[model samples]
Target chain A: MTAAAGTARAVWRRPPLIRNPRLRWAIYGGSLVYLVLAFASVDVNWTRVYEGLDRGLRFVEGFLVPDFVSRWGDIAQGMQESLTMTVTATVVGIMVSVPIGIGAARNIAPLPIYLACRGIIALSRSFQEIIIAILFVAMFGFGPFAGFLTLSFATIGFLAKLLAEDIEDIDEAQAEAIRSTGAGWWQVVNYGIQPQVMPRLIGLSLYRLDINFRESSVIGIVGAGGIGATLNTAMDRYEYDSAAAILILIIVIVMLAEYGSSIIRQRVQ
Target chain B: MLRLQNLTKTYRTGDRALNGVSLTVEPGQVVGLIGPSGAGKSTLIRCINRLVEPSSGQVTLGDTALTGLGHGSLRRARRRIGMIFQEYALVERLTVMENVLSGRLGYVGFWRSFFRKFPPDAVSKAYALLDRVGLSDHVDKRADALSGGQRQRVGIARALAQDPDLLLVDEPTASLDPKTSRQIMRLIVEICDERGLPAIINIHDVALAQSFVRRIIGLKSGEVVFDGAPNELTDAVLTRIYGEEDWSATIRPVDEESDDQVDDPDAEAEHHGPAEVLDRERMAGLS
Candidate 1:
């Protein structure tokens, strides 16, 4: 009886099993299945990968001595064009999106207008900027104008949707209280909606400007006129070193634009 | 100066929030509407401002028939009436000064109000009102930063800045502690008396209403059960208003006895496992 009592006491004193065994077993089985599938699907061989790595290293070594001395003029011109396209498109996009976004916000605008604006934004957002650029290239016949239009449409879709959401999430009581004070609809929007949304809109616009800069570089690949056009030409000619140089310049330009816009966004907000 | 005749409101859910309610408030009188929850006190107050449009009624403010006016005209008429809310309802992101200045928005242009460029007189009045509410040092603080009582003070300051002839307050003390509730009631009563502006307040506490208001309007199931001076608010009248004797029985003993009787140590020991029981018991003791 004494031994039985001691055993019972020891069993009772043990902590409860808080961790579920079924969940642990399921996770273990899932990982095992994933590993088996990954290994089965891969055609990876150590010898081929090792040989490919050497060739890549040798090709990169050739570009280590960048020959920017002869190509400086071309590089500067391309950079200028890229910066202008990005800035112009972003500015125009933000300027146009303010009204469109306000109209799309159902809390602010009438139902019909909100639906129409939302549909436009949706259409613009559904396609990639390159696809839109291709369409513009067809209509306007291949230039920076095509790229600008594409970027503007894409930015409007993204920025307007974000701005509309910001407007919707504002303190509604402020608007109601302003209305109660006999303020007109315009007055209520101006006082109640504008203050709350302005900072967020500015932040979103700056962030989009940075994204547009990156997108502008690639949109030029379809004869839209930027560094991307030159980069494509270099790649087609098998001038890998020149392609590497252009890639480096594009990275630098994007980084600079991102830094500048981030500073402005912080200050404004 | 404000009158409601046969005011009625029925929701789409088939709930009659206010059923044929009518009352009148003369200038300079503080009228208190007392009722249990869902007794249409809030609906009646909101209907006065046409915030909740009465289904069918005659609502007159001064010489104007409020119920008959068009939206634009009604909006213009609303400027003369100031409203204070239970949650304070000052825009949380805005500074105390800006929230107070918002009361003058009706008189200012859209561009001016947008930029927060209130008239010099309005700005001065906002400062004075803030000072009156003892929130002078907190003029720059955001509305969300302030405590419940301080936010209510800001609400009063905002309403007063409107220079209104009539004030509508809805459950101004419902969210406050007993001490803060009395303070807010005192401020409302003092403001109404000093400005000679008639005010209507919706309140749940009968004792608070009786202590602060000159006239008490009692509502039961969305209809007025009693309307008279605070002195006429008796146990029999309360029973009719609440439709139960439980509240009177609970309240009368507390009112009669100056001290709480539920402070027995043995009873308190039984409430040791959860503090919620003790907290509720303490609240019941206060009431």
Candidate 2:
């Protein structure tokens, strides 16, 4: 017994094994492995990079004049179409999403309805805007309508999910008190649910509108009507200067939408 | 008048919140329910309104059987039975006047309520209730801005706005200080007396309940352990209700006047003759 006690004491006195190593070594090892694989797999020819840089410099030098003087009419038309599609999609998406988002919130809706709405949102979010635009273009024969539909689905996915989360986090005490007044389900939703979620919903919708504007420029590449259709055609014909001008215009529009949406969001919040 | 006959509520997890509890409240009588935490006091009050539905029971308010009713009928029945919560349960974002007017939502149409077009009588009654609750000047203030005592006053006004025949208050003073608790209890008693409304109040403060209510119902572990007049509530009864003998030390009468004089700016400012008389009346009602 004395021998066993001494052994137990010695065991207790011994220092424990350190369980964790410094995570920085793991990061360094991963980076070294990635560098080794990259260097081993890639055919890094310096001559090709130099030639590409020269071509890029020549392209930039050619676009010094911007070429807007001749293509102003087409550029203006494309800008208008893009703006129209963005606004229409955002408004319609917001209108549809309010109900769908409320229905998807588990706290607000029944189990089956919440699950179905969540599934719909998941399906809408799974596809990229370009892929959705391609499908709509094939079905609706390639027009601004197709782009509008694609952006609407995308907007519903993002905005509705955010709005549902906001609804779910609302103060349930207010809802309970309202229900205690013998108010119907609709009345509870209108008075209790709407006031809490409205401000957040407005802010999210404005942010989604800005995102939809940027997406609208690209969806047109899939034969959906917007500035991207013109951009793609210019690129196909090797009109690099015209395509560069269109790219600059698209950037300007996106910047303006971002600023406008920021102001609206600040006001709402 | 309200009566709960053999009411019991067993949750899905098989925990019995209320087990075969029965009680009665006569018109214009304020009965106080006292119990330790998890003794089913809140459950008893909630079951009266069917807010938390009882597993099995008959809760009858006058002529209507509150239990086993359809959803629509239950809702309509709930309008006549006003309930006050421990946390006030006012919609914090809404104005005090709007919170008071919410009491009449049962009678208003959905479209009218959505547009905030309450009837003229409802608006005037809400204004009167605000005045009665001493919140007339704060009608437009948000409910979240009110202090605990003021919020409970708003809660009382909101329940009174329902023109209820039965008032069920669950821990209305639980979150308040002793002074504020006394004031809230006084207000409850005064309102019930003035309107001839029957009420059942649940509280953890045995002394406060004994002072304010004529009848006391003590609960323990989901059962009614003691039911008698407040005068008959002895230390032994408290021990039986709480499952301990050490709570007698905590049941002494509190110095409410000094506490009120220190914290309440309004009470301090109104320290003149009529206010002192009013305070005495409040104290008498509380005791």
Candidate 3:
């Protein structure tokens, strides 16, 4: 009985994942060496950084004494344009994406349709919003029209790809049950697929709206039109206080949008 | 009448799920299909509805040949064939009334169904079916909110909403407790009897199948091995159907269903090990 108790109390240790010690050590040593080499290649301009400290301090002080009263007209107009672009672009992009997203889902659509939809998504996603904004600005001249097109295009790629993946990953058994009922293709999609992905689709659209608003502020730096245009003009004129006020307004709007979207998302879920 | 002549299904992965299987069901007949896991019971049922397209076979219901129909015809054909699933595959997000009404999707137009607007006839029938299933109070409840037996009852209501001539019931009670399982089986059999609707129930439990079904068809590795009345399922016959096991305890007389006392711990132990009981008795006698 004593021996049996001793046997039951046998010690256990977790097995090692990497069986080859040399290979493991070699990989660790190689990563450390590469990291050190990568870090050493960086160049820093200490004198330039020191010289810019006073300018940075002025920028920081501008926030303390914001010139919102002077540039209130410009700020309000820019906010309106940004909000308009965000709303229209989001609505239009969502409308276009719904069909494309359905087509791209492997389980739902035919092989050819899936391929074409995926290709379109890939093309839209490859270019950054700033790059697309630059192209559209060149094509249509500098204004919110260019910004709208860019944001709408970017929204398509983001919304459609995620929506397609969600559709692909849906409960097959639910869809199968619907299909077994002799539901037509449209009927199956309306009942089986829509209900499953509605919440996610709403959540994603809200997220994209938030994203497009932030992006509208940015693309304006390239003269695509928004608050970023006003911000750029202030920067050019060295009106740091006005620039700070515009930045603060942009931040406040984005925060409100995010909070509102989150609340709405919670309600839907 | 429904007939499947030379029905076969070979999946994309080259797995022969069903091979040259054929069977027929007369009007108002309740057939129980018994098989081990992966023995093509599911594939066979799915083929009849053309949900899993049969590689080579003919599925005939009444005078219509179901296999070669175009998209429009197929949808119309599917409306007449009701199916009940094991997991009670109710759309979790939809309400019970909506789920039940989804059965009439093939019959209704796209716009009508989409707006949650069924014809008054369909709406009244849905309400009646819900009441019949003892879920009149829960019509507005989301399908995900129901218990196992209740969810299955809703599934039955949905299938009945189609007013299907033929019913394909796949493992209707697989995920339920023993009593719930029995209740579901009894309900299905009673419903079939009442409406004179033919049904094919793919079941796992041999005894449960024996207890409820009028006729049995045993599938062994994608082929039919036994098709006969429940009483003809002797020990050797069961051995032929389900490889081999000490099936004495598994088999029971149909009238012995009053033996819910079988759930008693004493009876369970006795059924499990007769040798142990005999040895204990012998030891007691010697002592």
Candidate 4:
């Protein structure tokens, strides 16, 4: 071929993630075939889908015209239990998380303490809150106490893991400056790392407070106690309106929590 | 005197940053160290405080051997040494006064420092140092709000607040403008003279180091290639330390000319963080 024709025919494209062209094309083709096979395997019954849609429309209607008066007593009691569990669990979780978070931060902690604390955080995070709630409910015989424990345990995983990551990412130069002054370990953390991470930690704690409140509502349905238990009872009786009322209350409270937390977070920053 | 006898450091990655380098700095002597990047200047300075821990060697400050100290005593010995960083590593969220007072954390108890209640002398000393560095009015301002030169001034105040015997300054002016760089160098050297304190300042700017410091030590590939008075740093010596490169522009007689007008407050307030150091090279060349 002439030089101009050869040059015109040549083309360049960005490199593929998998360097081997055959392997990359094969991978793409395999995923497309797998998607087709998976969809083919799915058994969707149109009859059941239509029934579920009809039932869902009733749910929407119940939500639109919620019955507040009939379920007001149970709703009030359940909300009170939920708020109490959320606040106490958050306070206790934060109190416990500070030490564990410090231990888990590799930059600050020794290897043994770091490993142990990381293991605790990983274990707490592995299982979903609902699973923990079920386990706690079984162990404690179905009460708000079990719900409280589940929420607190879940909070530890969430708060401590985030706090540890924040600590690890702090400015080493600032820490070095502090250490050069001959400060003790506690003093180094206070003078150097704490100031850098405090604003974020405060924001996280506020965020976690709302998360615990939300989770408390969920853990209650598994024989633990809160608004979810009230919700479960109403749902079992086919009292959609009462269930809608409980859901509305939970949403309103959660929105308020989110709004309040954001304001506080903005101020702290 | 601060002494490093055969100080060596080989990173875990098998990179030998410093190789059997040794030096002594006498009391009240200010030594400026110059080298190419990765030539072990930072490692040498950190080794004295055992901050970067010399892989195999000894660092002794006065009667105590720093390398052998346990946690408690290492801290005790460390309190006597002050460190200044290239980035002016102030606790950004803290008030300037708090950053300065943090230098006395070693002397005060945990609760006392935790509550920010320093010893009366340390507090007064911090105030005096802040005044000396011309940051007296900005003490209550957060460190992050100040200019780079101002933050470095706080770094100096913090170092002095320790009542330290020796100061290990790592690239003190690497992040500053030419004018501000000169100011900080003058301030550091002046303070060293006033306190009769020994210091090892690792500076990369050949001309700037030559202008301010009396003694100079050059490092090349982890060894001391040149150690002499600044005036003795000729073209051949520059080539030896930094490898063969045009040295005429870098090693001329000190300009001794009037500096450019002071930078505006807004310009000063802009961050001269490490990321901005590249832009400064052209400015350094012009100056």
Point to the candidate with the largest lDDT: 3
The prediction achieving the highest DockQ against the true structure is: 4
Chain B TM-score list for all models: 0.86, 0.87, 0.90, 0.89
lDDT of 3 by residue, A1-269 (tens): 85877765568777767779898898889999999999998888899999899899999999899999888898888888888988999999999999999999988898999999999999999999999999999999998999999999999999999999999888766787888888988988999989999999999999999999999999999989988888888888899999999999889988998999899999986
For residue A122, model 3's alpha carbon misses the true position, in angstroms, by 0.5
* Model 1 TM-score on a 0 to 1 scale: 0.79
Give the worst 10-residue stretch by lDDT in candidate 4 chain B.
Answer: B278-287
Docking class of 4: medium
DockQ, each predicted model = 0.31, 0.37, 0.38, 0.56
After superposition, the stretches of candidate 3 with alpha carbons farther than 4 Å from their true spots are A1-13, B254-287
Off by over 4 Å in 1: A1-70, A249-269, B13-15, B231-287
In terms of docking quality, model 3 is: acceptable
Instruction: List model 4 lDDT by residue over B44-89, tens digit each.
Output: 8877887776788888899999998998999989889999988888
TM-score of each: 0.79, 0.84, 0.93, 0.92
User: Which has the greatest TM-score?
Assistant: 3
lDDT against the true structure, each candidate: 0.79, 0.80, 0.87, 0.86
User: What ranges in model 4 sit over 4 Å off?
Assistant: A1-12, B254-287
Candidate with more favorable, higher lDDT: 2 or 4: 4
User: Is 3 or 4 the stronger prediction by TM-score?
Assistant: 3
Instruction: Report the C-alpha displacement of residue A218, candidate 2, in angstroms.
Output: 1.5
True contacts kept of 2: 0.62
Candidate achieving higher DockQ, 1 or 2: 2
